[model samples]
Target chain A: MTDNEQRMARAGDYVLGLMSEEERDRAEHDMERDAAFRDAVLTAAQHFHKLDLTTAPEPVPDQLWQKVSERIASLPQMQAAETAPASPSKPRVAANARPKRFGLHSLGGRGGFAIAASLAAACAIGYFGALATVTNPQPVVVVVLDTPANTPGAIFEAFADDSVRIVPLEEFTVPAGQTMQVWTLYDKAVGPVSLGTIGAKATEVRLQGPHLPLPKPEQLYEITLEPSPGSPTGKPTGPILVKGFARQPARS
Target chain B: MDATSDDDLCTALLVRVARGDRASLGELFAREAGRLIAVARRILRRSDLAEEAVQDAFVAVWQRASTYDGARGSARAWLTTIVRNRALNMLRDGARLDYVDDDMLEHFGERSADAEAAYAALPDREALKQCLGQLDASRRRSILLAYVVGFTHGEIAADLKAPVGTVKAWIRRGMIALQECLS
Candidate 1:
């Protein structure tokens, strides 16, 4: 078969759910890189999707929505514009921007407060080391922050005492009069609080953050570009260079 | 509402969902969950498993809503793709299926029937229906069983009483021809 025909056939296999797990993964990866392949897959998916719509709607269990709501109550939506890559070389981010608010308020629920309290108990055990009493030695949560381009930008290890060890994964070129400011949203009510600010040159620096509730899983951490020292306003004012949700390290 | 308007509403709701609007997500769920469950049930066969698939798909939708591009496809199609993939993954996990048993054989028969029923039910106006109808019966059945019910090549071979290699080729050629016709 011709290359275009082969691509179309593979796209058909992917849309039909016929590919093996490994093949599916590769096709998805290819879709990210190849616009033609992605278009083919999308077209095929749209074409076959009519079959899915034809199925008669079943009676959903009354509690199903409740269950879904509870599960997503603490989850935050990734902002399309904020996650958009600054450069044109990266994959295009969605152009639509409806809700423009930033920080914890964007999360739209108080359920995260309950999760934070529970996470503190887990943090007390200190999975990384036996010495739990060693004055904030272990990180409560490790966040691998990624650029809007989805490349690793930085790694943040937040401690119980709120001191975060920042490791820059990429050499972010902070403009002549600009600095990279770190921020986190621990609660919707409090909004995003500034963690610290780094200079023009990126480096590994530990910042002592304000004493707050213990860091929890899925907490938002981000770095934004602001004028000289920092944002004239306390909140992140400029474009987000990188951002990610905190995840707890696996228990050893 | 007609399908196009419903699709437009879904797209609008999804845009709101991408912005962290939980209420819109709920609205989308209330609107689409029943239909999604039905679609998933075809592949999963069990009501509870189908519900699980829909649940997972919603959570994924919440997380990845920002990635949804309208230029790529309709919101309904995107949602369908997510649920279908989830259900397919659950089936491929193989933990739920008891192999080679009489019960499984019965399920296989039911699955094949469901696949054909889906194709037979397709609207005559749909180009997909015309293209799929034109394929050889074995090829068409093989593609349908795989797409509609998440059947693997080996399962299709078993269902059609044909060799797995021949079934795979039939599907590959069938898909090429189908795409060519549809295009």
Candidate 2:
């Protein structure tokens, strides 16, 4: 099929819920980047929505509304438009921004490579300064995972307390039935253990991982796409989206 | 009120909801919740789960109303999409379904019936009805099963007694043709 035909077909699959979890993720990611595909999906979705309207209204329980109101009572609306008046297309811009590539010229594969150039350039400016002032214990080691395409995907700060803070540089789309699983190869014999899983929208967040020996230098850190809940095999089975080697943060 | 004006009112109320107005959300809920619950019920086939889906959707609508761009679609469509997505997710989560001892064949039969019932209910005047009518029966059934009832390719294959690959092709080609006719 022609490219446009294929795109329209995929859009239909998306609208019809026929795509697999991974295919849905790719389609959603494409929707952000491809205007035509987005338009196609939206149009198809709207058209098929006529069927939704035909559904006879069911009796909504009085408590349902009350429950919804209570649930959202503490939640705040994300005021994206009002907050960023000058940057009307801020989300679009962020979506389009390529993952930052750090200068890895001198750093060879799986080496400590001192926390000098890339760390300072990529992370130190914001996270280091902010984290230093916070009451949270200092991270034992930091890792900058690179996408297979060699662009920095996320930053991981492993702490002494078995908590890891993840700062994703790129917006990885995790559709409903899938999750992003974080893993570390602390021991080759033990294999890669899951730190935890995160939902679709990735942001700077801390995850309390399983108790293991203090994370050391050059430990493998990676994130993979897995079935919801986690990898069934309890090992890294899915395709790794990003991977990196750990580096001990220089003591202040 | 007519559908267009009802949709317009929803858009206006959603704009207020985006500005942190709780009353507007309540209004939208009063207006759309019943219909949304019914829509979710078609996919979930359980009133309690349907209610849960609509409740979650309302919370999401409250939290993410600011992101709603009316230029993309109608407020009603947006609301329906959110509820449908939530219901589909709940349906896909195997733990919730727990098909262990239940008659899997009977469940599939009922879901397929729900899917067809939805398509048959579409208004005769709707372009969607016309476009869907143009597709072959297999194509049309596959598309309906997927959209109206959240059937995966595998489920549709099982329902139609066709190979998975064949069901996938039917849906892809069917959707392409449906869009062409709609456009």
Candidate 3:
């Protein structure tokens, strides 16, 4: 563009998260490797590097720490169940084993906190409905909604809540052309329900459970790559990026 | 305990974190949180807001421990980058940018023992610290408060009892000058 416009960039916008939804797209549209930009970032990063954390401060609130710990503790167990062995057709090493040992049943979600989100449980056992088949229940299909990295994003407590979280594996890089979309499958339903797109890091999904109050346990969940805005087909047309079963501990 | 040594301490803590050791992570948090909060408080110019920035930063470090690459920079450098980016994201949203919570525990701790070791061999390490010392007393103070503390230009202006525009100029100039010195 103009020489003047280049200068402002030379100064680098002090603004963090330099690209917004649109800006990011535009920047990537015809992105090129520029040494000047690289130098500027390096320079800025060095200065940023100097900020001291010698005095990290007092511990954060116990509540926040508690919330984080709970989230972390539940995550490994939930991740394991979703990662449990799938059918022999897709036989791979079982990655869902406990933290360092073995124990299928857990008390808190894993052991017994009535695992609330078992979507991955269903997905992991894909087509193994018989294994998950409970005598009192109608047939249920579970889907472990995960990223390409196999990190569990959400366990659909119910399709109605439409609730979901994009669990990250490092900061994911979404290429310029495609966006991530979440979907769900029910036996009678036409196809996966769109949960919407998310950022590279964790993002909260707004559920539109207009029809259902929340996704029932054992429902199938999946994420797929679609066009910039999203898929016009209204169903996942691209390769299914992540799919999983839902297993939630029964409410006692 | 100075910035150089601080970076060293961060690296040691990160090594422990990568091993999935929660206790060491907590220890690191206990040591670095306050300074992080203090800088954040200055940058946001609101104590509560700054504290949130620090908390989010630490939580992320715990979750993404595997991604930290020591080859790129020190642990302190990597972490400061995380904290700064998160804080800036919050600012960009133009939210209240003020900390708010009941009985929010502030982080506290001292310069790391590792930092002391790193500090010993630092040649021209003081270049950055010394450059910061050279600014006009007021300009230098404002820049240091903002640079080290993460205070925004506006917050620095208020703290130094100067105009926002003036604070902005000092930061811009200070950073530019600081850049020159570092290079």
Candidate 4:
């Protein structure tokens, strides 16, 4: 087949879930960087979904919608009224604007977002050895935050003192004039409370809040861009960049 | 409502969802969740994983509704695309579809009489049925197996008792033919 036909066919394979990891990664990267490739993938997706006709409907679990609504509540606020394709640009936060704090209203019912434990997700924890207490070693929990496409974004570690250490593993940068604020949601009923402002240039930082309780299992950590200094509203008002669930470390 | 009206309702609900309307989301969920779950379950094979995929897709819809342009496609198709991708990703990340038992693969690919009847009943799916019918049995089976079962080229080859290269060629050519025929 010719190159165009080959590319279209490859797009078909991608939508069909037939590509290997390496091939998939290359195609995904193209989808990210190449608009034409993105269109090809979209077309392939549009066509491939028609095959759903072959399968019969299975009974849906009762609580599935509840679970989904909760997850949506936990996500970062919608970027804008118009949905924009994810571009190479970093998330931007408006300056001098009162950042909107996450509220529980948008979430349906009382069942807020569930950060179910994904302990099996391979995550590397880098603890500052000097800070490790020899007499009372505290369990350090690490969560590798990923993009919707499953690409690793950052490593978030919560300590015994409720303090969180944010480390950049892959490309994550807050544009100049904007600050990246971290937040956590402890309860499904409660909204995400701000942790603190992180430096744009800083690769790693330990965030400590005296009033906040220690980190617990199933707590979600997310990063959102906001105006300088921090969100005036004490909540995230910008797009969520990366997020992950903190699961209890596997017992030794 | 007719299918076109149903599509319009979905689009309107998506607009409300984009505006942070929770009730509209609930309405949309009530309407489409079952169908979306069925689609995901078929690809992921595990009910729990399928639910997870469908859940993620709805959450995505809530967040990404503003991105939907009516000029491009129907809202139902957009929703299905999200759930389908989510389900396929789960399978890939978990390596759930990497290995398939030969006996199970045989059963999975077999088209039941009931399934044929069901396919014929859906008028909206007639074009797809006709397009799929035009391919030879192997190519059709390869396309259906890959789409419905989330099978990789190697897996399909193993099930078809063919070489991997030959299977890949068949899938690629088959897809091209389908695209051309559909267009």
Candidate 5:
């Protein structure tokens, strides 16, 4: 077989979890640019896919299955266990339920665009001069915050107290009926408590954290646009307008 | 333990599950446990390890049910992929697939040496077996090496001591035959 054919066959194996970690990575990369190669891989994958997954994954012994059922049935959130594929039937979330981004889950293909526009509006309002300074006797130092990659967005300054003020990197216009809810999460939590909500063209966000013991690692700060009364669920139910994670500066 | 694929029962169980109903989750499990655990065994190659893997996988599904995306693949594919990945990792982390403990070893059956034991032994395994049986041994072996052991085509070719071309043909022919058989 040609290198191309061999590569295509390898991609099928990778999808099947047959390849080792390294080979799997390589196959994934090669399959990306190779359409014909991908088709061949999918062709083989469909064949293997037909193998009654029901028959291959041996049944859990009666006792063990019972134990698992008991444990799963005991959890407060048994959604995962219930969705676990058991019979030959399809799943509920299999091609019908859609995931929403923000604004009580504002739908459509442009969901991502709305989030960007909100951030842009926030940024546009900031650089055009929208910062409110409170006369606190504590020392004020400028702190740099970055998103996934450091984009020109916003900066934050904290008072001696755990409260910090967010200064936008650009001027942004937030429409009425929408508010920016802020949150700080240290670890992967199911629900993150809200910090506070900011209004339109509001450059500075004043937040008090009785819960923020310290500016811990992975302590994320995100701003989501919620409804007027804020998220009734106590979490940011809107699209994230702006977000940044604290990163330590590198010393020379 | 479950044999009936009653649609209403399945739908009712899912709705309660969405509402965080644990009892419903148990009922659903009782109905599906025999089939799913059987799947775990074939993929894991050891009943004991398969039992634990299935147990862990199910509990995880229960906790993260809301995260399921309908646009992805079928629920069966999703669940099977999870357990299959789990079992593969369980073996990949070690050098071999043998992880049977005393409890599992004690329950040994006649033909436990085969990796595809669950799928092969099942009456439901008919379609795939007929499909695969149509292919020559060399082609079937290549497909099995890839699916059963999760070996890459290169690995299959290397292990079988054949050129990559022959391995690819065997896999292609085998899959085409399968698609027809299952269809």
Candidate 6:
């Protein structure tokens, strides 16, 4: 065979699955880099698929269709599936088991000033200068807490200063005499650590300085409904109201 | 053979699927599922693997329906390519054909007159049949074995009782000839 014939034959082999795994990988890489080779491969694939025209159509088992439908229905978000290609999407591990909805809202006007003053005072008295300047130097990791159903609930911003700021995006009602407590879990395998308590009517709570040495990504930030003082066990004793993972801003 | 109404119908269903219409996906499955499973069965040579391939292909169809370009190829051809690739991946994963009886493989190769009629009825495929028929018997069967059953050159050589190099030459020449005839 001529050189052109040999090249086309290799392309044909790739389309027909005659190449070994390594050969196939090299050929696929070539197809991606070389337009001519890609065209040849697509052409070969189009031509070879004609063979199926003559093959008799077989019956699909009834149960197989059910399995496929059930699987598609179970996807967490069908919105992503609409535009996704044939190849699987990037697999991601949520710090928690659920997907989160994030909405960033700034604290503004008079309420913002009072809260900032109280936060600065809280930082000066409780944390000392060691933790105060920590956030000023490093990146702040923010966590947006949402329900499993993808409703926006709250936001947790972790500063390098070892302080975590929690803002409730949605209203929460604690039972009579009960308080809402915030917690953080760097690892799901380990249990949560209490950050501080917040009033039922409070719109935001900035934990002055928690025991976290540094704010890390994928740390779970959650709010649980607890007794007035807090969980006696030093762990979350009530049901979790909202939760999410800390994330760094996507780099440009 | 060029852009028939059936092709248009498949493309329409795919567009609906891209818009998140579950009913359209069901319609596409209803129309094409049997043939897709049959193609998968030929390559995988086992019912269980073929079923898995078909399920995966439909899931892909759901995920990739938006990527379908009608100007590029027929919708059936596009969907068939996805099924074939899925089945071939299973075959390449060291899924042997040993579980299937010999007659099953022969059944895949067998074509009744009605099947030939059905092939001729498909848009553009009749041209394919005419081109394929023009090849030598050995060349035609070698190409068919590779395309339909996902056979390697060595497997085709073993099946045809010919040397591997000779089988390779036939398929190469056969493909070149088909490309010329179809064009």
Query: DockQ of all candidates, in order?
Result: 0.25, 0.20, 0.10, 0.20, 0.14, 0.16
- Runs in model 6 deviating more than 4 A are A1-3, A79-252, B1-3, B95-125
RMSD of 2: 23.4
DockQ, computed on Cα atoms, for candidate 5: 0.14
lDDT by residue for model 5 (A1-252), tens: 556545544554555565555555445444444556555554455345445343633344557757766776677534554677754321111121112122212333344334333332332211001111111222123355544345656765433234556777765556688766666665565457665665666565555543233354345677667877567787777776667666432211
Task: State how far residue B68 of model 4 sits from its true place (Å).
Answer: 2.9
The docking quality of candidate 3, as DockQ, is 0.10
Best by DockQ: 1
Mark the 10 consecutive residues where model 4 chain B has the least summed lDDT.
B111-120
RMSD of 5: 20.0
- Report the C-alpha displacement of residue A30, candidate 1, in angstroms: 1.1
Write one digit per residue (lDDT tens) for candidate 4, span A123-199.
10000100111111233467777765677778877653335667877665677788878888877687887777776
Instruction: Tell me the native contact fraction for each prediction.
Output: 0.45, 0.53, 0.14, 0.35, 0.27, 0.32
Best by TM-score: 1
Native contacts retained by candidate 6: 0.32
Q: Which 10-residue window of candidate 4 chain A scores lowest in summed lDDT?
A: A123-132
Off by over 4 Å in 1: A76-252, B99-102
Give the C-alpha lDDT of model 5. 0.51
DockQ of 4: 0.20
Interface RMSD for each candidate model?
15.2, 16.8, 17.4, 17.2, 19.1, 20.0
Ranking by TM-score: 1, 2, 4, 6, 5, 3
- What level of docking quality does candidate 5 show? incorrect
lDDT tens string, model 3, A1-252?
Answer: 244335223333332233343443233221223435434444555554444433335435556556545555566643665577742321111232211111222222222211211321222110011011111111122344675667764533331112343343334456778777666665554667666655333343333222222344566777677776777887788776667767643211
Q: Which 10-residue window in model 6 chain B sums to the lowest lDDT? A: B110-119
Across residues B30-128, which tens digit of lDDT does each residue of candidate 3 receive? 767666665455345466677777766766666555445444445666666666655655655554533431211131111122223222323444565
TM-score of chain B of 2: 0.95
The CAPRI classification for model 4 reads as: incorrect
Model 4: lDDT equals: 0.62
